[model samples]
Target: MTTLLPPASTTPAPGGGACAAAATPAAAATRRPVVGSVHSWDLSTGVDGPGTRFVTFLSGCPLTCLYCHNPDTWRMRDGKRTTAADVVAEAGKYTRFIAAAGGGATVSGGEPLLQPVFTGELLHRFKHELGLHTALDTSGFLGVRATDALLRDTDLVLLDIKSWDRATYRKVTGRPLDPTLDFARRLADLDKEVHVRFVLVPGLTDAPDNIAGVAAFAATLGNVSRVDVLPFHKLGEAKWQALGRTFALHDTPCPTPEQVTSAKGVFETHGLYAV
Candidate 1:
């Protein structure tokens, strides 16, 4: 299961930008234009990225995935307004802890690219000020927003490739798949380190052709270091219900171990590392 820690309290920074001081009151009222809508954060190990991570959950997503656990993050307005300085201040508190564990900061979503400026600034500070590695967890729906300048600061990308077929992609996530494919190609061109994620839903995304398509695509990207085939689960049913939304996969079974192994086999067959 993904470990979720309590939300980190934020304080305003002395200033804005990548060189801002890491001291500010936690109760500051003003919101910077480059600020992000933050939902929550967690300190996790062996999941989000390499080593332990101080994962910041920035709110505002463009895609509406069927199995999104944190449905509360769907909207752009329902989150704490925080500047890059505030995030850096909060993450600074654990600098030593994170470094000791060989982990860094991961800017996850709702989609981090939705708030490109804030995400970029936060990434810059995390790497320059704190001397930490940076990773971005995104579906690439808004990948166009990830400018070359912003991507220059990012060390790795946890790219989620939902499906291979365009129709099935639209069904799983209320968005097209070509943009993600384009983003993947761009990242490959830039030689960015990427860990590709694909969730294996039993009835929706477990088709042999879909798996092969994704794996074949990944194999073509020399920058893709690993492929993570995640199993679908009903862990977010309650969240959907609490939000007064229909949970479409109530009867959808989780992929069995054999199914997961088979999916992994697809990636392996393409000469890509899978887990």
Candidate 2:
């Protein structure tokens, strides 16, 4: 079973920390945004719904997931220094297209939570000024207390649940599981709309018992609008090679359609709806 730690007594304070303070002004200036690394944008990932989406891959993540696709995003000092407004302006050009098609901006990355100030500011502008649908794709590794302010204007959360078994979770992401589970539950309790995502890696997260465990836990979340079973792929292998890091899941096979079908069924059976 997933264990949830008691809600933290204090919420993380609003405004930028040293990291944000140091980066924001520069970002605000030349739009030469720098975080960990400023990699080129790939408009793919298929996360944005039905419309033209503007996605920003922020830098820095806490987890070292074995199957991490963007291992390059792990560092905290490599990206360009673009302000929140810079991102919004660029995304604004496509706003008309995104709106007509029912899509908007999605902030994804090395864990957008790692850059809370920038993410918060960006979302704030998106909602109050641009009036766009904002989506946050995160691992939920950053505890809820740290994220309360950030979620205020977020329209949707694409939460990635790495594992149901704590031990297995640590093996997969090199981090404890409780905090992530707590983050998930807190979002649910707050009535925040969320879509749970699980990457099904054969022999790792694909065991029937594990799938059932995840489904059972997800079922308890009253605000989960959908559960997505993302089949494992080797798309990030080359990226790892480019970054001079060993691809840990090199031998892990992608899940068969049967596995995806079966896993989806498990989620449905447990009362957690899947999309």
Candidate 3:
């Protein structure tokens, strides 16, 4: 629940060169772009799909969601240095198993868009080289300029909509909601497949009206594949303490199953499929 804003100045890699030459045929097949930082990878968390899917937890995020589960990933300099080729080589080992189980690599983080060049390269290699499914878990706060070519190779977009109301969104994420909504609309317009996710945080984002509003907005989009209502939990409380950060939702309890069900119902009522 710690709410630490990202530093004002983030140093992106110069000229945005390729991290390294794709050594293998799989790597050579994809055009990998150069990026600033090669943070760490998360071999844990099997949430991407079936099989043993590898996850790359990139550094940096723009949003300050009060109930973020991975506070440790907020900083832009916390993990080890690695390049796109490094990640691809590591993930390539389990490509066969992942593909057989309908699973592949998932790029998650404080916000993958913060390192768009690196993310795009990873997706390119996953598709053109390894021929594996690629998914991006983002907050949708990134602007149109940052998402242009990146969306072309992404198979699935896990778009997290913090709140429906503009004012409420600012309160929850410490950023304007318009950019996020615009990004979602652009994804829908481009016919990109997306899964709209909303975190149901009690006393903050679980309001009935807000849920209904988000559903209504999603109904206007043509490429919405599903809506996922994630119940709030204190999974990252300890991380906040370890980081010496103050938790914002210290007294907030986890949402009940009924609450999650009700929120899902709202999306269903709006003609958008909810999961």
Candidate 4:
């Protein structure tokens, strides 16, 4: 999940260009403008990353998380075709405002790593060309797809550590929990700055043990600079209806303020900053 800690993609698209295969940094720079399936782009503050960020939401994701708010981004074909250059150019317009706000740019997805080459191109150009701080928001399921060159351009990572309990994690994302953990350890090894995100769903992911599990692991990472305890909401329920898919958590209530505070406390107890 792109920090929508949302389920996103890594399965290569069928067509050509960056969506098809990995490309070296030199290849990405010299090759024709890398292309990708993009959902939308917008400016937002607080949640995505530090400052006021120009966030790009790429298309396609492999997992089908039950509480996904952005179900519309689940498929590559559903998005409009665009190029990395075009996306960067769009972000370029906000460089001044973003800089003033102490923000930069973020490449999020259905999964950015799903389209590694295109994503890398966007990040590299965003940092090197636009002179902006860049972040990659992902679930880390496809962390293997993120080449070293890509990580070089990423100043921060907004990672969704959905659920620490294996069974709950699978029930929530329809995938095993290990890949995300593996990726977390890898990021720590690289000493990458990471902001861990956890969605506090009252019934789904609010168990004390689950929260403790995630908190303890994140504290061990040594590279996690912040933790965001996001509250669950029905904001994306309408999108699910439009997609003709049942919103599994339609009746699930958002986490209470107390629950959110307690969850944050768990991380704090582990010696990690939480908000």
Candidate 5:
């Protein structure tokens, strides 16, 4: 979730002339415009979306979450500059398989909304052209960037709400909490389908009040169809080490299954289906 932009490097032409510049910009404009900075792509099941999925992990994020597993995705320049057409072409390969299994495409991130135009175009292609269900996995930090056109094509949104309290949210992710809240409200107003994901860390986000607060807020939003109370783990510790960053929860224990169940109970108490 850390938003870090590494300096970009430009490769000069061998002849070192204006002709090189012309070839680059003109060709780029003619193509999909290189809007989606891609980190990676993969196939997932029973997780990102309804059934199976082709997940696109884009680059760049606004919030620096302490538990971010893919710290390498923080820098936009580090990702491959890809176009929507190429993305759809790749997804099209498994279109029949995904459709048969009641699955579709999911654009996850660093923050897919960081490149709204690219994400929008990709989703549009999947929904309109390929006849596929489209989902966006986001932190809701850049929710304002989700234009109506984009939302129109997205069938589901996997919004990761880090924390409920503003102070605690800021502490967990080096960003304000309001933007995510505002985005959630927007999704509700649009009546968009949403699956809320909340991680339960033993010492950080496991406070009873914090869990209750998130549950209360989610209950207010009628669009929320499900709550995923995930247990914290050290899965991302290696990534942090590789990045030469401090892994804050190194010694913190993960939430016990009982604790996870209790957190889910809070959401159920609010009459929302939670797991």
Candidate 6:
């Protein structure tokens, strides 16, 4: 969560020259302009990707996860109407610095796939125009919305597996586990690079069998390069309270260092790198 707030203002940075080479005139003409509900944009490092990232948090999501900290982002109407070009322009302001740090651009949630077309445009422009590495941060629930072209533009994917057991998965995110597993398998088939994410909730998802289930599935995906064992935290409890919603996991304790280490060991046992 090392995030820097969006700059007060942005100017169009140099280089849309790549745009001409990126698409054919007829294709560009037929395509509708990309617009989206954007909650915010900022700079973040480490967890989001290999280097510092200009992360665009698109608004709206289908899931109502009990542990979601950014409840403010749940509704699409709450976000500002933004164009994909404008978002890429803002990221351009930091292109040099980001490239210097070996960082890239990340399209994050509410759920990037919630606005697939907009998310796709941003990824395409971020890579082709900005000449930066690009990552897609998504839950993979709407993986069907992601066209093959979108995945091609995305250099990496930060996919949240969340849970393994079907019932437990629904309890955590109010969604079925099948779609995520299906998406993981698809990414594997494509040989796409993926960093599988799991949030270790002490009483909820920390069960040995549940963790083992996730580890075992992820290990089967040849494309999985890393397993991020994130411990659940209540930092967003206030956001839930402020929004007048009861934070169900209000009293959920953050997993201890030992618990985290143990969970990491589970993935390592499956021959996957864990962090």
- Specify the highest-TM-score model's number: 4
Candidate 1's residue-wise lDDT over 1-275, tens digit each? 23233244443345555434231222121243346678878887865898889888988898989988888888877877766676787789999999999999999988999987778887877887898999999998888988786788899999999999999999989999999999999999999999999999988999999999999999999999999999998888898999999999899999899999999999999999999
Q: Ranking by TM-score, best first?
A: 4, 6, 1, 5, 3, 2
Greater-lDDT candidate between 2 and 3: 3
What is the model-wide C-alpha lDDT for candidate 4? 0.87
What tens-digit string does per-residue lDDT give for candidate 5 at 1-275?
22223223333224634553334322433542445578888888966988889888898988788888788888887787666667777889999999899999999988999987678778887887789999999989888888787898899999998888788899999999888999999999999999999989888898899989999999999999999888888888998999899999898998888999999999999999997
The list of candidate 6 runs beyond 4 A from truth reads 1-32
Instruction: Please give the RMSD to the true structure for each candidate, in Å.
Output: 5.4, 8.4, 5.7, 4.9, 6.6, 5.8
What's each prediction's clash count?
0, 15, 1, 7, 3, 0
Candidate 6: residue 97 Cα off by (Å): 0.5
- Root-mean-square deviation of Cα positions for candidate 4 versus the true structure, in angstroms: 4.9
Give the Å shift of residue 172 in candidate 5: 0.8
Against the unseen true structure, what C-alpha lDDT does each candidate score?
0.85, 0.74, 0.75, 0.87, 0.83, 0.86
Return the TM-score for each candidate structure.
Answer: 0.88, 0.84, 0.85, 0.91, 0.88, 0.90
Q: Worst lDDT window (10 residues) for model 1? A: 21-30
Task: List candidate 5 segments past 4 Å from native.
Answer: 1-34
Task: State in Å the error of residue 174, model 4.
Answer: 0.7
Per-residue lDDT of candidate 3, residues 43-83 (tens digit): 43344533455677787888877787787777777754555
How many clashes does the backbone of model 4 have? 7
lDDT of 6 by residue, 10-46 (tens): 2323455666435532254246455778898889987
Candidate order, lDDT descending: 4, 6, 1, 5, 3, 2
Candidate 5 global TM-score: 0.88
The alpha-carbon lDDT assigned to residue 257 of candidate 4 equals 87
Model 1 steric clash pairs: none
